[model samples]
Target: MRTSKTFSIQFWMDTKKSKKSEGLIYARINVDQKRLSISLKRKLAIKQWDSKNQKHLGASQTAKEFNRYLDLSKSKLFRCYQELRDNGEEVTSKAIKNLFLNEESNGYTLHELINYHSIKIENTHAIGSIRNFKVTEGYIARFLKKKRIDDISLSKLNFEFLCDFENFLNAYYPKGHPKAMSHNTVTKHIQRLRKIVTLAYNLEWIKDDPFRRWKSTFDKVDREFLSDSELARLATHHFKIDRLDRVRDLFVFSSYTGIAFVDIRNLTNQNVWIGDDNGNKWITTTRQKTNCKVKIPLLFRAEKILNKYDGHPVTEISETLLPKITNEKANLYLKEIAAEVGIQKNLTFHMARHTFATTVALSNGMPIETVSKILGHTKITTTQIYARVMDHKIKSDMDAVQKRLNEKARKFEEESELKNLREKIVEAEKTKYANLTKEQLIEKLNEVLNEKSDTN
Candidate 1:
């Protein structure tokens, strides 16, 4: 149950709109009942045009060539229509017009694809994802300029082009950035490029995938988090400065709840509610990064922090659960707090999330499946990357193994004692058999054979 489509093209001139002696040539396209027109950017005098045949009425070489060009344009338009239809794209007059103009609907360019992707994900993807697309687009524009290329066609994307682009990225750095691009950063750009390329291929804008041979990988990085003692120190140490105290409270809250900075900053009273299990308070909200729902039960410490900030002037005005502060200022204050408290770890808001996953959750005998759910991770592997194994976990595992080994050794000793008893019994039977005379042994054997035959 699909509608059939029809396409037709014609050459014409708008005599009423023409202000010059020669009228401008145009190609008119009709798709089903819809119509559209594209200017050929050429002009022909009324006397030179053949109205009946839609050709120039002349024998001059210039006239013949112009007629041939018109025929070629018509043929190309038909081919574009057929290709689009075969690719299962809805054939519209505007789509055909864009194809003729080398726009994104047909012959997609790198810049056009980037813009399209940016617009497409504006509402659907995270802010970080959108920013990455914009940054990638800027880098691509610079790369093209450095190579003296106007624009790259989707068909021309290959391994060689990717290598050149990678080289360009290594040498290129954005303005105001402190350092050159790293391998992982360059790899991310290539990943975004691959995503766009895959989209183009799915849409039939490109026949071959250029990234088929390209390999992308990221180096593992060690992330820092607080230990249980360090977290307790931060919680107990009182600061004279009010701002530092507030930042400490916020960081500690995140460490206990496993919430990121953006999600924590946007938390409201509505997100906190009494759970059915023992009426414990819980935070029910959606993670901004993955849009996954996270329901974390607020521990005593996290609840106390919230209670301390309840009904504050800033919180009341903002209708949020906590006072709002810029992330930059929070990190700056964290460094000062860390220095004052003698904690050497580079303290950041995000590190609190890592701490929650490691020290507060996994290190305390929490299941990784539950931790992954609490952290709003789409996969358990992602949580594993975030959670680091502490020395205590290893020691606990080895302790369990040693206990199992002791139990196994005890069982083996008991089995060996039983085995010795059975051997003694066998020796006593052998002595009894050896004491029997040959005639008595032969009589016993004959009697056992007769009993076995009767049972069979």
Candidate 2:
């Protein structure tokens, strides 16, 4: 069986300083082949040493932290190799490096893999996932600089390391930013890292998948949709009366259609079909996201918008149904419209997709499964968020039911009043019978009973 080599990065405090004395500095680097690892050691500030206080002034008390760092790198590497060897694979430092350096693994070093795998999803896997992966990559690099793609080891990836990175992200991120990553963001990076590491293992690059049991830390996001009041406000919002207006209208159109921006950009006159086959005029098209064809009974408003924009001049001479607007400009216009409508939420191209899912589709009592297909979500869970927003519809139905019950009660009260009046008239007639001595009490009682029954 093969074995991994052991190494350590040592830190030492320097006592001598040639300049104005500051706190002592320490430095570290790994060495294994009997060569001295060189680094500039931090100098202790003898001038600031407090004999009475028994502490070094102007020095960060990070001796324990520095020691932990040294232990972490060595221990993580050893544990990673042990995991591989336990899994019935020969393990050595060279073998580990060779596995990590394989070009098929995206030329990631061991350190890169450890750090990269710490994140759940990576941008390299797909085009749409790039934005998030780029953010994750930047965060890791900012905290841990210049990590070679091949130097990652398991010991470097314990729970503490993951937590520390998350803390670092939260602390360093600027205040009041909506897109600032959460714990779940950290988890996604880790998950992606795990997936890539698993690939490496299958390729015999590493002996074991250390992240196989790792879990994520993000709570479910409350997917919000526009309320009726918000939608009404949006409809009346006056967008900038220019090309930006065109972009806004297209975005609104997509919200109603539940088409993603990518799909909308690719749309053309050919994609729209009027089906007389169903004995009614319906706009039929397939969503590019899910490749699912949908036939929506055309609303007059939707049809009007479509016709107004039909065959609009495209300067680019492309077959796109709408004039091409860059995503950045579109987003800017959306934010402007959102502000005009008093929507405090940050508006994006993707928000239009969510608006369609909740406002245009699910709130109208559409089945979630159908909505999912319309939105082209790969999972039912993706569609489930709309179900949560449908709570208001359930409340509306309950209110309608209560209104009906109240109306029924009012009608019953009116009938009861008439019955009481008829009873009183029969009693008056009986009282008059005593004076006349001809009208019978039995006839009065029968009249009253008949009147009450008729009223009922």
Candidate 3:
């Protein structure tokens, strides 16, 4: 059975809740015998409220303005009800009240949405991802505070607001910081914001997409890696300090295997196994950041280093494959190692993986596809970033072309010399035949044929 829908708005003063001579004004909504109430955020004396007419009672200017406001509010509430009914939505007093309050029933403020999204993904997302979202939420809150806004309705979010937020992010600095964020850092923050906005839009909390027309661009940065010579120096150089020696060994291991620090830290004996091909040892592990499987054939030097630390106390106690150290200390020790080795590039544990991808694999004619798999890259494009075009690779490519060109030139020269010799012999024979008559030429041809037959 179909039920009739009814909605009506009325203004009244709550005399029972009045603590002083003035009572607070309230709007009461009624739909199909159900009721919902909301404060109108105004106050009037009990004597001024007209119970029968549902309006202010005086003819003064203040009373006239208050009555006009109340009339407008009532009309807007009725329009809200009519629109909801026309749109085939359930016409309830509460729905009409929400519309009148300018708050979408399913909407959330920006910060609230961010927090909600963060909580939703707290367990499923990686720690780095969760931290980034948290930082992004803080940035958004600061931006809103700077604008002196307590909260913004999702419906009020538009392209202009996004632009203003982006501008704020570009100019934002942490406390005691002298410079604003870098270009890529700002891009990252905006990306997180876009994700939250997209979630809201997908959930139908917002009608319009604020980021539809905006394009995010990040600056390309040149990642640093060690050259072959520098890598060799680090590999062969003997450090007097035992701590530096251990760090060097770990870095060299990464340079050979292309495994990242976190994955290496989590490695154990079980991860190393004999490959079916060639019966050589291989490191099979999953990347910590992307969770992509990486299988790398252990190089001679890498195998040697592993064997060297076979019975170390730290490795045994930690139940890890290698001597483990904190990432902070590893990087700090790498700096000292860089200085000791007389290398200019800043040494980080991650750069070891880059060196393995470029210097050890690509420059030595290893296929990019194989390099990408060894490095645990989900995309070849990501591997390409580490495989910068090296000077030696360029030289080797050009040298192969030069060698082919030289061989072609030499063959052409030999063919030209043979052609010139044949032309000279024909000219000499023709000159000798010119001095004789036709009979003499016939005789000479017969004689030459006889001489050739005799020689055969």
Among these predicted structures, which one has the highest TM-score?
Answer: 3
Candidates in order have lDDT scores of: 0.88, 0.61, 0.86
Q: What's the number of clashes in each of the models?
A: 0, 25, 0
State the lDDT of candidate 3 residue by residue for 322-409, as single tens digits. 9899989999999999999999988899999889988999888899999988888889999888878899889989999999999999
How do the residues 257-355 of candidate 2 rate in per-residue lDDT, one tens digit apiece?
777777777766766665677654454576644556766555554555576677667623776667678888888887777776688888787877788
Backbone clash pairs in model 3 (N, Cα, C under 3 Å; residues 3+ apart or in different chains), count: 0
Model 1, runs deviating above 4 Å: 1-106, 173-178, 418-456
In order of appearance, the predictions have TM-scores of 0.70, 0.56, 0.73
- Model 3 residue runs over 4 Å out of place are 1-106, 175-178, 277-279, 440-456
Instruction: Give me the displacement of residue 13 in model 3, in angstroms.
Output: 44
Compared with the true structure, what per-residue lDDT tens digits does model 1 show for residues 1-456?
Answer: 222267888998767766666888888999997999987778888778887788888889989999998998898888878778788887888878877755323467777777777778889999978887788878888889988987988767788999999999988766899888988999999898889888877866765688888889899889999998999999999999999999999999999999988899999999999997688999999998999999999999999999988998878998999878999999999999999999998999899999999999989989999999999999899999987899888999999999999999999999999999999999998988998999999998999899999999
